[model samples]
Structure formats: structure tokens, C-alpha cells
Target: MKRASVAVIPAAGFGTRFLPATKAVPKELLPILHRPAIEFIFDDIVGAQIPESVLITSENKSALAMHFSEAPNLESHLQSNGSEHLLEQHQNLLSNTTIKYAIQDRQLGLGHAVLQAEQLVGDRPFAVLLPDDILLGGSSFLTKMLAVSAQLKGSVLALKRVPPDMISRYGVVSASQIAANQYRIHGIVEKPSIHDAPSDLAVIGRYILPPTIFHILRSTPSGALGEIQLTDGIAKLIESEPVFGLIVEGDHYDVGTPQGMLACALTLGLEHAEMREHLLEIFRKWSQK
Candidate 1:
């Protein structure tokens, strides 16, 4: 098989969880350590070696489009200031990638949001990444998942072993071990109660899905929340085809909420070898007060 040719990112949600700050800014544009959250996602997508990406966004989210677009003035300004490194960084962001945009008219659920990119995706295996979930590690999460998909030739979902008590917060999957760090998914239960959860394995945001999911997403009716849940569509896909879960070798931070965002920044800051001492000193000063 010719490797998944495209990646579809769903960025249309209102991000009501962040409230006032998000009122004027799309949550995807929120910055983490001076870089927009979506920039991290784009970097990961590029690391996966996929040549094309489709960003599914809403009308109000034009800021995201502009951010990724070429900035000749900014490039020239950086160059004039002798900041050759910075200019190269800006150039790298636009190079070696073909980006396409698809508009989602309504803020439906994730499944509906992904369906909007069907035409761009065409009939082939593709990846879907949720910007809300930021994953960090020595290796790219998508890259590892793609390797698993290449070997299995089936859908692959990044899995994390969450606390049993927190299973209700995510879509939990029941799976049987297929090999080291791999599982054949038997079924997926979305946000089930702790007592009802099938397994502790929860599906994070990254996915390698076959094109059949588009039809499943379209046929899947809106749920009680009047939104098409991606979990529901995945459940339908599982009925007819085999789906696998690859336990991602990394740490995942849910950046959709305020607390989670702070945690991610702190974690990244603490891990920075150059800034660790300064960050620790600041923490110590705050503790003394």
C-alpha cells in the first residue's frame, strides 16, 4: 500500500471550555511557549511524513489560515535584522507541505467535522488529529502509529492507559493484545461510567482511519447531544472491519481545558534543559512567598 496520503485536522469547535479568551481567538491559535497549539500539531503531522494536510475549520477561524500562510514582510523583516535562523524557521513552516482548507459550516461533533473533509480526502486511508490533545515524546506519535498501520493494514488509534476512574472522560476501547504494544480492538465505549468501562485503554486524538469511515460517519445519526460522535462512527466501522489500537509511546496533555493547558506549558518548560534552572528558581521563589 502507498502509505496514507493525507491528514485531516478538525479545528471547528467553539472551544467554549476556554471561554472569555476564546471569545476572540480560536482555541487552536492559543499559544504554548510562544508557538500556537496548532503549530505543534502541524509539526507532528509533518514528522509523520504525510505530504498533505486538510484543516477543517469554521468561518470565524480565519486566524488559523492566516497564521500558516506565507508572510513575506515578516520574512524580510527577520532577514534585515540579521536573524537568519528565525527567517529559516518561518520558511520551514511553509516548505515541504501542501495544505488545504475545508470549511465546516456548523459546530457539530468531531465525526461531522471530519466528514466535511471527505471531498479533499477522497477514497484512501488518512490520518485525523485533534489539536485539543497535545502529545509529546522523543518520537512523533503519528509516526509511530503510521508504522503500526503499515504493518497491520487496518485502522490505528493512539491508546493510553488512563486511570480506570477517568475512563468516563474519554472513549475507552476493549482490545486483545496482538503483539508488543499493539491490540486488536474488540469494541469501543464512549465515556462510559467507571463501573461500565470495558477497559482502561482510552483513545486519544490521533487516528489512522480508512476511507470507509466517511460513509459510516454520514450514516451515523446525531446523538442525544445533536452531534455526530466520532466514537459512534468508529463503533460502526469496527463491526465490519478490524481496528487496532497502538499504545502511544509518549505523554499526552489535554490542552482543551485551562488547567490542562497550564500543565502542558509547565511540563514543557520544566523539560527544557536550557530553561530548567530558571524555571525551577522561579518556582522556588513563588514557594517561599
Candidate 2:
């Protein structure tokens, strides 16, 4: 049986980084351009032709579901004016695909968060996306990772070469070459120092994982951080079955941080043909200050 119907998204993290702003509003609902950050992730999944998605979120993040729901009042207000077209865009966003929600309840870690959706995913392979990390490139990153999984018949992760200095901020992988732009991962280090890093390649937030990962996640003991790290489970998975890494062809932005979020918004805003001239003029004025 082919197992490719589900995509799992873990959005349960408390955005302590953004504090007061995220206190009431879920960080995932924060705007990148005009659309919320999570919406971009959903768009990418839809572009990949994934039929369904399960978002694992905590009670605090309920706004995510609300954002995706039909806003009848808002739609009516928009239509009553001459803004019916805007309503159509929003309605299409909600109606384009099916989405389910699962509660993580606790903030254990990324691995534990993903395990929350085991029931929703059942015994099939699923895609995992971290909305905080916006992958900016054509040929949707998830689609590219899924294609590699389809060919190799194993778990695959979106990997990117990070600066050596930044290695400590990401989950670094030690891999053996398998083919061009592909690797058979031997182990993964969780935020290792630059000197101690196994390799410069860091595992980005996207993953195409098999259902078997749940077992590893359950059995793997929590590390020093008192949380179950996803990289640890992936390392264990490597021991038993093949785990490959595909070098993502894109600029990755860590929108979880304020600076990163500003950069992402500015970069994407400048790329918009409609907003390009105005944005450029503002940039030029700001540079003179």
C-alpha cells in the first residue's frame, strides 16, 4: 500500500521569543507579507499535492485553526463593500484542502510534538513542516524532499549547509555520501559546537518520515535538555534503516527571531511586483537616515 496522503505540522511551541505580541496571538498567525506564516507552509503542502494535513498545536495556538476557518462576518463585510474579490481569496484558502488538528498538550520537544499526530497519521509515511522556518525557493522544498523519499523508499530530511559559526544553533548531521546532493546519514548532533560538529550540513525543519519514527521517538530517552530531541530519534532511525538527506535549494529564514522575521518580510515584500517600487523608495529613504 502506498502511504502518501498525510502531512503533519507541529505548531505547539510557545513563541517566547516574540513574547507580548505572541502572548495572545499565536506566532504562526503572524504575518509574513499579508498572509500568516503558517499559511505559507500550507500553501507549500498544497502545492506538493498532499491531500490532507494535521496540525499539532496547543490550546494557546487555537488561533491557527480559527484563522483557517470561514469568517462569515468578515466575508459579509468585505462583500457589502466593493471588496468581494478579497473575500474570494480568503474563502479559497480555507476551501482548497482538508486540515485536521491534534493537541500536543505539552512542550516536550520537536520529536515529542510530532508523536502527538501518530493517531492522525496512522501507519503511513507523513511530511513534517516547521512553520517558523520559511523555505524560500521554487519547486516547493517539501515536494523535493518527498520525491527523494519516493525514490529511496526511506526517510528523508531537508538539509542545508549552514555557516560553521551557526552550527551550534541547529541540528547538525554526520552523513556519508550516497549520490549527488544526497547522503546516507550516520548520526545527528543536536546543536553541536562548530569545532565538534560532525558536518556543516544542518537539518532544516522539513522532514519526510516513515510511521516507524514514532516507535523510536517513544523509546529514545530524553537527553540533558530534559526534552526529546527529534535529531536523536532520527539518529536511532539511521541505525536500523536508511535515512537520507537532500540539500535544500533555497534561502532559509528563521522567522522565530525578530531580526529574521524582519529580513523575511522585507525580502518577500521587495519581491512583490505590486509593492516593489514603493518598497524600494522606502528603502532608499531609510538608507539616507
Candidate 3:
């Protein structure tokens, strides 16, 4: 079983959902609590023991790369100021991992963004995690997916059962139970209407894809959005290969929207020991008002 050595995170989206705020700042750099949202994805990648992370970003988001790169001036300032705490936090700057950048100059689609990493991930299995979908939990769904991919030698996806009304918001899959919490994905439909949806198992951001996906993505036709949907390529891959899905356990939150970002910040803030009591008092006063 080959280990997934590289993780590809597509961060090139215009983040139109977060306009003005994102006008000068990339959404991936948006802070959830104290750290940037994309850092959580990096934490997951580091925890899974994956060595390389390929961030697919654009010219406008060069800060994404700089955020992970070494900053000599900042380091010196921290050292001279005796800000050991702050300095220690950056000790694992970029987690001391090899961070690569692939430029996605256009908003073609998720498939096109991921294709940018083909050369870097040649002939090796890779993991793709969307930066917008933040998972908060103790265990790593990615670690399990990697293990499954290794055992089955097939691609695996992270799935969560969304309500029927919300099924259309995601790429839903028709799957048959293969084992406890595991399923054999039979089909994938991208943002299908409820009436035509195959099942309620919505595909989330995490995926352990075999290198073969790049080839399929190249020939896939753009969908209604005029963007190359990743699901389109996955659907095609399943035609000649096996694709599995695991119902992941996590507090899933989509922070692509302003409302969602607020919810995530509030949720995470309330869970922090230092802020829990303070936030409780704030919420209590708000309720009285």
C-alpha cells in the first residue's frame, strides 16, 4: 500500500461570496480564531503525516505562499523582543514541510485547479482538501481515507449525509453499504435537483485520489457553471475503477459565506477554554437585550 505523499489544496477561487473583505485578503487567509482557516487544513495534513502540500493559488493570493514561507525579519523581531510564545508558535512554520505552489491563473473550475498539480504528484496517490470546508473533531477523516485507499488501492471520498433539501448544495453520491460507515460509490451527481438526486450522501471536501483522475479531468466537459467540476471527473473515473465513500464524523461547517464564517467563529470561540466563560457572558447579555 503506497502512502499518500502529497496533499493538493485548491485555494484559487475568487471567493466572491466574501467580497470586500476578501477584496484585499484571500479567503483562505481568513482567521477562524487566531490562526488562518487554511492552517486547520495544514494541521490535518501534518497530522496525517503527509510530507508535501501543494497549494493551488493564483497571483492575487501570493500571500498564501508567503504565509507558509520563512520570514527572517519577523523571526528576528520576535527573538529580540523575547516573544518566545509567539516565536514558538511559528517554530513549525509551514510545519517544516515542503510547501509547493501551483498557479491557477483562471477560474475554470475545481478540476482545472487540481490539474495544476499533476506534474508534482506524478504517479502517486494524493489527497485533495477544500479550504472552505472546515472540520472540527478529534480524529482525522483524512487519515482514515488514506488507510482505506491504501487497503483497497482505490480512490476514497469523505461523505456526510445532508438533509434532502440541502442535497442539491453538494455533489451527492449513490452508494451501497460495504461495511460499517463505509460504502461503495456507484454514481456521483453534481448539484443535482432533489427530484433527480441519487442519494443524500453529500460529498465533502476530502478525497484520496489515484493519479488516474488527472487524465479523466482533462477530457471532462464543463457543466452548467461553465467550470470543470471535479465531480464530473470522479464520476467518469468510477466508470472504469472503484471509488469508495466513508461517512466522516466531524462538526462540519462551510465558511465560504459570511454567515457561515460568523457561525464558525462563534462556535470555535465558545469552545475555547479561555473564551468560553467570556463568550457565555456576552451571549447572556445579548439574550437579555
Candidate 4:
């Protein structure tokens, strides 16, 4: 089994969900407290000690490119003002991680966006991380998935037990429990209605995919959304190879929606030393009798 050496982050969507705010800024760049949501993605990747990342984004999103690249002018100013820590945080990340961008000219879909990284990723195994999905507790998610992928010698999907009512929001899987917290996924359905869902195990944003996925995606065809669905590709992959679902213990949230984002922010805010007491007091007063 080839160990994944790079992470592929697809950040090219129009983020129609976030609207006007995303009109000016990419959803991935939206602030999660003080840090951009994409920073959280990078934090986990770097934390896992991954050496490279292929960021699949649109050419229109130049901000995404600029955010990762260094600014010598800004660094000089911060140094003179003794506020170097601001730049230092990102500087450390840049030093440890090499980020390469793959241009997805059109906002086709997640599968199409991911396909843009084929040249950069070549034939090696790579992890797919969605910036919109905030996997708190850090790189442990990636580490666990990578380990699972290695053992299975196949693709691994991060699985979570979401409420049954919300099953349609994700690609649900049909799997047999092979071991503790691990399942051998025999089938997967994309956004199936509650009546059709096989199980409550929702496939989350984290994925450890093999390069063969690129070819599958190319011929995956468009779904009802008139776009290539990554879920469909993975489902097809199951026919020829091993695909597993791993349920790792961690706080995972789809912060792409306003409510989800706010909930994540508030939860994270309460965990920070400076905001914990203040946020707790507010929540206490807001609670109903």
C-alpha cells in the first residue's frame, strides 16, 4: 500500500450558500474566530506532518493564492512594530508545508475540482480535505484515516453517525462492521431520501483516496445537480477495490452554512482561554427556563 504523501484540498466552489460574504471572499477564507476556516484545514494537514498540499481552486480566487504566499513588505512592517507573531504563525506553516495550487477554471463540482489536482498529485495516494468541514481536534483525523487506508490497502471515508433526519444532506453508506469503529463499505448512495438511506453513517469531508480515483472521476458523469459527484465516483470505486469507512472520535462540523459556522465559532470560542468565561456567561443568560 502506498502511503499518502500529499493532501488535496478542493476550495473552488462559488459557496453560493454563504452568498454576498463569499462574493468578496472565498468561503474557505472566512474567519473562524480569528483564523480563516482554511487555516484550520492546513493546521490539521501540517500537524500530521504532511509535506505537501495541492489546493484545487479557481483562478478567480486569487486571494486563496495570496493568503498562502509570503508578503515580504508585511513581514518587514510587523518586525519593526514588534507584532511579528502575527506573521510568525503563518511563516511557520509556510516553512513546514509546501502548498501548490491547481486551477479549476469553472465551478463544476467537488469531483471536477478534485480532478484538477491530477497533474500535481500524479499517481500517488492523497488525502482530500474540505475546508468547509471543520474537523476540530486537529490532524488526528487524517492520521487515523491514513492508518486505516494503509491497513485496508484502499480508500477510506470518514464516517459519523449523524441524525437520521439529516441523512439526506450527506452521502450515506451501506457497510458491514469489520472491526471496532471500522466498516467495510459495500455500497454508498448520494443524498438519498430518508426512506432510501441504507444507514445513518454519513460520509464526512475527510477522505483518503487512491490515484485511480482520478480516472473514475473523469468518467463518473454528472448527477442530478448537472455536476460530477465525488460520492458517485467513490461508489463506483467500491466495485473493483476495497473501500472502508472509519469513525474516528472527534468534533466534526460542516461550517459551510451560517448556523453551522456560528455554532462552530461559539463552541470554539468557549474553549479559548480568553473567551471561555465571557462566552459561558452569555450562554447562561441566553438559556431559557
Give per-model TM-scores.
0.96, 0.95, 0.96, 0.95
Task: Report lDDT (Cα) of residue 250, candidate 2.
Answer: 71
Where is the poorest 10-residue window by lDDT in model 4?
Answer: 132-141
> Model 3: per-residue lDDT, tens digit, 1-289?
3778999999998889888888989999988879888888887887788889899999999888788877889888888899857746545646656889899999988899999999998988899999998888887778999888877778999999999889888999999999998999999998899999998899999999989899999899987778998999999999999999988887888988788788889998988999889999998999999
Model 3 stretches astray by more than 4 angstroms: none
lDDT of each: 0.88, 0.86, 0.88, 0.89
lDDT accuracy of residue 96 in candidate 4 = 82
TM-score, cand. 3 vs. native: 0.96
**Tens-digit lDDT string for candidate 2 (1-289):** 2446788988998888998899999888888888788887887788788888999999877788888877778878987897988656556656766899999888988999999999989898888989888888787878878888888888898888998779999999999888999998888999999889999999988988888899999998997777888888998988888889999887889898989998999889889999889999998999999
Expressed as tens digits, the lDDT of each residue in 1-289 for candidate 4 is 5889999999888889999898989988898888888888888788777899999988778999999987989989989999999877777888988999899887778888899999999999999998878887645688888888888888999999988789989999999999999999999998889999999999998899989999999999897767888998999999999999999577887888998899899989988999999988887888953
The residue-by-residue lDDT of candidate 1 on 1-289, one tens digit each, is 2378899999988889988889889999888876788877878888888889999989998988898888878778878888878646545756857889999998778899999999999998999999988988776889888888888888899999999778899999999998998999999988999999998999999999999999999999998888998999999999998799998776788999988888888888898898788899999999999
Model 4 stretches with alpha carbons more than 4 Å out: 284-289
- In angstroms, give how far residue 85 of model 3 lies from its true place: 2.0
Model 1 ranges with Cα > 4 A deviation: none
Candidate 1 steric clashes? 0
